[model samples]
Target chain A: MKNSPTKNQISSYIIQSQEEEIKRIALELHEGVGQTLYSLYSGLQFIEQTINSSNMKSYVNEMSQLLEKTIQEIRLLSVELHPPTLTTLGLVPAMKSYLRMFTSTYGILVDLDIEGQEPNLTETQKITLFRVCQEALGNVAKYADTHFIQLDFLFVDNNLTMTINDNGKGFTVENEMQRSSGLAAMKERMNLIGGQCLITSEIGKGTTIDVLLPL
Target chain B: MVMDNLYNQTYMKQACEQLQGTIECDFVGLAFQESKGPNIGWKYASGNSNDKYERITLRYGKGIAGRVLSTGRPMEIKYFPQNILGKALEYPIMLAEKLLYAYAVPILINGIPKGVLLVGFRSETSISDDEKKFVEKAAADIKKFLSLEKM
Candidate 1:
């Protein structure tokens, strides 16, 4: 499945497929790998308790440590595969939870202003939009050197709108076109929704992003 | 592993530089999360000229940025000042930034928006389909790198 594309198409196809595959593998890691590993650990613990060979005990202890590390990695993998929050609480709430973590982890204040009752969006819509926002914020956290950030949402008149603004160094859109894929993906999501995306910035003023989606 | 505040500092600054080249606009950045936790909405700039945008925190559905964040989508305004109602006092960031034509993209993690990415052209620059593609690609790529999916 990974090697069927033409040369020019291979990279993009591989990346897309890889991401999808990773999601699948991550899920398997959670549901199957995780359970198997835990069961093994439990079995080993029982063995360690019942049979008291000193050498065997030491070997089992070492294996237990290794298993513990694997378990942690698997958990991480599972989260990556499909964020539990995304499934449990829908897109908006999931982002709220993520923002809490992002704010604390990065020490960046991300003020959220979401208005209008949310209409149920398809899972794909939610994921696509979520992915785009994740990328944009990552750039802000990595590049936008400002102390205040605003995230606003509006669901009015059957149109879904979003905006992100920051007081940081601004750039030229033409120049940005030459570098980076983050912006590209954002636009794709908007287009998929038959929506529009716009970006504005200045040398020392700030940056603002606005998006509108047909509900 | 815990990523220190230094990481945020570095990235925010880097984002400004990157935007300058990528967007061909100017200023960049916004507020950073404080050590104590989330704070009220505010606008903070680290690149270009910082003026009106720094004054107030936008409520959801207000202003260009607010609209995008609130809806969790993207917006394109070929003639920003002309298209929007009132002036900078009403649209402070747009007025201060002197953005005549602007476009914004919402950054969402999980299902909600975490931030926004904006690019503007001075005077009367109409957003092209190609340019829109660029913004979307950049937005998604950045999210993937940030591991927002994990969040």
Candidate 2:
């Protein structure tokens, strides 16, 4: 007799499908709406130069400006939804690009320190790590009230470890773990990939998240 | 370009201070979309307890400033964290400034909303109609200044 899938397996499948859906939407937003808006902006510029009346030219200019803003917004949304670099250039580059955008958006600087050579990683492992980091950084931005963060990536023999530390107002780990679905999801994602996530915090000191994966 | 940005910053600071004085509010903040990017951030603030406002950046419809920019309208919250549509965390400005009441109006440039001017009160108080008008006037002045600077 065939065995039924476990709860963890079902949730893992759901998370995988969700990621695939997000990737598809991100691609559509980038290539479809984003490109169309760019062309619209160009067309407006062309019309602006040909128009003889100053009033008409000004109106065209404003339209172009609005279009430009929309294009930028769509571009950012697409990247935030699913960074193309993660698939193309691999984890480190993708993380760097994401950190840059995160700093620009939140004005919180993340100091990344890498140790040892990067080991070969499966696609699932790479994506899982990326998603976990993204979720962790988002929490830091929302609740940390911090201006600075430290992310350390360490690679040892057949093992990879990542540590994220924030020097901001912390909370009780037990209470927050129950209250935050994001934290739960992070742990679930790591567990699906045979990894462990540990979170520790103090009220006045800070919070630290450690993720360990064995290859 | 650098000089123009500096000029805008100085002007915005002065305008925020003027508005805070006239409106008798505890804080006044000006958030603007970057000229080269889509990020909207609080660039200037008056009566700010800390520099935390400068660290906040929102997308099109996330926070108070973002909502005002997207909707192109004025928004007023008399009792914050209560009767609000979403989570209190969504209003970063209110949380950062510890404000109980806030009024935000869009700064329209060429009929396009490109910025937000917000006034907040730490203590619970209803904003008078005259005070609302002052905020609107301040937003108009910022719109005018930005439009002229573009040329």
Candidate 3:
């Protein structure tokens, strides 16, 4: 092949391109679809207050409730496509806010412990870590049997380390690779930044994901 | 109330159902002004056999809806006469739906026509003056239903 790139290079390029597209679509959803929905809701409120029939009022009330839920869904979708704070606030605050959403939606409790000081990280590195964390938490919510999760961070020897542990019915790594692309995507995100990801799991036990990032 | 996709669909379905009972027509449809286009097409229709009406776009003075929308007036054809239309090629929806007679009520907001509500019958029949009044009132009510946007 002429000017051939490695498979890893192609995959990293794909990820970076996808992130850029996500930002564009997220803004469109928030501004276009989201605004139209807001206008509809406001329209319903006017009808509800002006109407005198109890039966019609009830019908209006039901539709208004549905609209409110829809507006929230769009807002959530826009935020998930690209978190606005991820770039400006850096990794920790972004992850912290993300974890709040993640736990509230999944109804799981996460105990996060930070050690040492926050290390200097490239924007790419920070985003990679955030994606890795996102993937790990998604896996936990999907497969974990336990309600509790543990997240630990460390900085030592010019390396930044993070672990995500879940008390879930751990699947065989080989079997999981065949079943889902989640782990592969996580590994790809880590590999793009020269980070190391170690996923350890055993049947009837919990799963642990440890990531080491050279600072 | 913020309109979401699902909620919008549900609201339209409900409105169409209510229109059927009030207008007592075989078909009930709503068409809104296209945000970027000068033409309008049926956006929602219930009691429709297929989506033919929704697909036909209408320009001002082009179809029955076009005339009503432009004039901000309600119109009705009591009989489905072959020669009632000015031109055969002008009304694609009439041919598509095979509507014998129909009524169009201009959904006006601030005396400006923003949309049109169309109801039709399959066969030639008279739309009573009383029934016509009801359809006109429904158009006014729809405006009130949309007034919350200003708030």
Q: Report the C-alpha displacement of residue B25, candidate 3, in angstroms.
A: 47
Ranking by TM-score: 2, 3, 1
TM per candidate, chain B? 0.73, 0.93, 0.87
lDDT for model 2: 0.83
Clash count in backbone of candidate 3: 3
Model 3, span A1-215: residue lDDT tens: 59899898988888888877887787778788989999999999998999999988977865675566567656656666666566667677777777765553444578888888777677678778888888898677556555678999887889999999987678898889778888987886887788889999987788999999887
Candidate 3 C-alpha RMSD relative to the actual structure: 17.4
Better of 1 and 3 by DockQ: 1
Error of 1 at A90 (Å): 1.4
True contacts kept of each: 0.00, 0.30, 0.00
Query: What are the per-residue Cα lDDT tens digits for candidate 2 across A109-209?
Result: 89999998777787778889999999998888667777789999999888899999998889998898889999998998999999999999988788999
Write down the worst ten-residue block by lDDT for model 3 chain A. A99-108
Report the lDDT of model 3 for residue A122: 76
User: Which tens-of-lDDT digit does each residue in B5-102 have in candidate 1?
Assistant: 47644664566467657666554434321223222133334343544344444434546665676577887666755656433233435555656676
lDDT of 2 at A177: 83
What does candidate 3's lDDT look like per residue over B1-151, in tens digits?
A: 2222576557766787898887677887787765553436677776775555654555555467767876788877655546565743344455446567888989876566767888888777757889888778777766777665435
Best by lDDT: 2
The per-residue C-alpha lDDT of model 2 at residue A66 equals: 65
lDDT at A25, model 3: 89
Off by over 4 Å in 3: A1-3, A116-123, A155-158, A174-180, B1-151
Instruction: Give residue B101's lDDT in candidate 3 (0 to 100).
Output: 83
Worst 10 residues of 2 chain A by lDDT: A100-109
